[model samples]
Target: MATDTTTTAPARPPGTVSWWRRPWIAPLAIVTAVFLATALPRYVGLDPARSLVPTDRGPAFYPALVTHIFTGSVMLSAAVLQLWPWLRAHHPRVHRWSGRVYVASAIPTSIAALVVAQFPSGGVAQQVANTFLGVLLLTFTLLGYRAVRQRRFADHREWMVRSTALAFSIVTNRFWSTVLIAAYAPGALTDPDIGFGSPEIEGAAVASAWVSWIVNLMFAEWWIHRKPKRRSRVR
Candidate 1:
């Protein structure tokens, strides 16, 4: 009897994809473009500078706010790029450089977040939520950096997931704010244009702040643990 020998390819890892090479990347790229379009203008150059300074937030607010916006934009873009598995797998050098930029941006972004939190425009609840978010962002990003340095990829991924979730608080907060504002505006106790002390605004602010990062992180945790494990087959 003659036996033919053939080598079989190993199975692809579950849920893995060549996201960078797929046509489906268009949707992701479009979304990223839209994000850049909306978020960039809000925090870039003279636009925000003119709007935030001298009159409204005062001179003291400029430094923190400026740092927050600039670093935030960088961090947001970097974090988004890092999520593409193809980039990390194929171009590890680029991934490392981007990771460094992301972590560096995260440091100042988080610090400015805390600074701005100290003078939160919302009520007590908003203040507490903001403070918690700022601290969590800083702590998680630092922990992620440390984990990666120590070659603890699992811990790094977890901490970075947490960090990115917090970073996305701004986006989630805007979404919640829009929803709540529209829903509560009719029954609001005070005019929307008036003051932060308004009960309606305060309630909405607190609700948005808490729901934003909390909900994001909950989903992140779910995603992180959603990977299916291979089981041993028993004969």
Candidate 2:
């Protein structure tokens, strides 16, 4: 008896994707979400520096602050689109245009950050962190573009990853700032009041930026080197 000859189709694997690989989705989503959340607030009548510790720089500070907000908004917005392959392919023109905008925005932002670093209300540690941020911003950006120009995808990806990570330092700085304030200040922490006098708060912010970047670099290295190592092992 040929009972119930009909057979069910095999089940597909869970979490499968065809257009883009699964691993990339998380990073892209994170970068996009961060960009929108951070950039949108700047224009929504929210002051970026409201949470920052006040600097004694006086009126000159407003202009710098305005520049920081504008440039940072542009930078973050551009960064969100950078990692999406669709933008680079289906919309090559937009990609190139946005790339130019990203580079342009980075100049003023990096310069302003470096300038502010010198007089950071958090003192020397904040200054150093900002300096490193500025230098890395300039270095990685140039390297990424240069790699692309030379058709070196590997180098371009490496440098761009580093640059993107540094850009996220803005996010990390705020996150760490909040964490430190919560741990150290408890109920005393408030918006529009950066607890700059506390060395612990300042140090945490500065340290977070460096730590974030270093961790990002290590991850990138592992990603880039892993395949080669595996191939060598197989051979």
Candidate 3:
């Protein structure tokens, strides 16, 4: 008779997330999904009228803007999926496909954003902020891609983390803009005359354009540089 010596993996404790899972990621994915659905409806119709293009922007601008939004929405959707750890762990093909989609969508989106940022509605500061953001996003995304090609997966993850943070910054930009508008334009919610285009709100919006991504990148850096806990040696 032979004695069985098979060992099974221990089950996870109930109602607890694995340490491998980042607590912030799932909630961020959900918020990104919901906000994207609500905010991007105007672009879904591809109506140039909805976009409120400044006349000097010319016909080319609207198309580029539409491309930027359309592709950016795809990038955002893919990004939400890409960052989900379970999917990456269990469904590698899905992860790869989403990554491909993200990379493909990001390039055109960044390029179009670079074009659009030149004609900022808020102010020179906002234009400079957006242009800077567009450049960084494009750079981070490419570096991530290059890292993967070179088989430097750790570096790839870090770079993608940066690119994704910047990509998702638009959501924060909206949140910050609303808060800043409320602060800058008192009674804005109640007063019909204090429209979105009012100078007070415009100033706030300009501030938000800079603040949103800077805040996001700050958080991303924190996540990236956080010290890992050392496991105790069990005798």
Local distance difference test, each candidate: 0.76, 0.68, 0.85
Q: Write the per-residue lDDT of candidate 2 for residues 78-122, one digit (tens) a residue.
A: 877776665666777887788778878877887777766666665
Residue pairs in collision within model 1: none
Overall local distance difference test of candidate 2: 0.68
Model 3, position 19, has a per-residue lDDT of 43
Query: Per-residue CA lDDT of candidate 1, range 107-181, in tens?
Result: 999898887776655657777888899999999999999999999999999999899888978766778886876
Worst 10 residues of 1 by lDDT: 46-55
TM-scores for every predicted model: 0.81, 0.70, 0.86
Ranking by TM-score: 3, 1, 2
Model 2: lowest-lDDT 10 consecutive positions: 226-235
Residue 47's lDDT within candidate 1 is 54
TM-score, cand. 1: 0.81
lDDT of 3 by residue, 42-93 (tens): 7778776665444356667777888888899999999988887777877889
Off by over 4 Å in 1: 2-7, 12-29, 47-58, 186-198, 227-235
Sort all candidates by lDDT, best to worst. Answer: 3, 1, 2
